[model samples]
Target: MAKSKLSEKEQVTEYIQKLDPSLAETITFLRQAILAIDGEISEHIKWNSPSFYYSGDMKPFNPKEYKRDILVMNLHRGTTILLVFPTGAKITDTSGLLEGNYPDGRKIAKIKDLDEAKSRQKDLENAIRNWMGQIEK
Candidate 1:
């Protein structure tokens, strides 16, 4: 029998399922919330993890590289999950959810569990939207 292929979402879901269940659950919550931003927001596997993008068309980025990157942050070896804003150095964090100071205009938000992910949902959404706006400029 021919093998069926999994969609990008399914592939990412499957990949996360193999990690720590709590971390997987947290990531899943964030994924859904991120997708709810708008119709243009899309996701794909990047940096060997789920990456979200925002463009006029709902298209996923090439997995080979995070070209025109937006967000490329996730669980690092099941230790801690981070939401990276590769082009959001100037993005403000009024919610006090973002951390890390990289020189290359990158910022990250560390999400520990479903509760934390839930608490920071609004902030995450804001960051993503703001980041997308920045990229457009």
Candidate 2:
């Protein structure tokens, strides 16, 4: 039998399953929090990590714009889970969830552990929703 390719979400699940239990819990919680914001947002493996993107119909634009990308989980630093928000410069964040400035229009939100993750859950979701609200439908 041919080897089957895992679905995007299944791949994400597998990725989370391989993490340290604490990190896994945090990632899973944040993933749920993000997905709960909008039904159009979907997940996949991108940039060597589990990434989320908008799957809804939108006005066509240049692929270089990366308008469909929502966020990608960057776990290179171990305990610190970094959510990379592409085009995050567009969001008017007041919740203090976003940090750092990159000329490429990328911003990052960092979560350390489950306690911090739970506390910042609302802020994180708000920031993501802020990103989603600007999407061209």
Model 1: which residue pairs collide?
A: none
RMSD, one per candidate, in order: 3.6, 1.0
Q: What TM-score, over all chains together, does every model reach?
A: 0.81, 0.95
Number of the predicted model whose lDDT against the real structure is largest: 2
The TM-score of predicted model 2 comes to: 0.95
lDDT tens digits, residue span 25-129, model 1? 888888889888877777778878898876464345554433356687566746678788776677777787777778766778887778888888998888777
User: What does the lDDT read for residue 8 in candidate 1?
Assistant: 78
Instruction: Please give the distance, in angstroms, between residue 132's alpha carbon in candidate 2 and its true position after superposition.
Output: 1.1
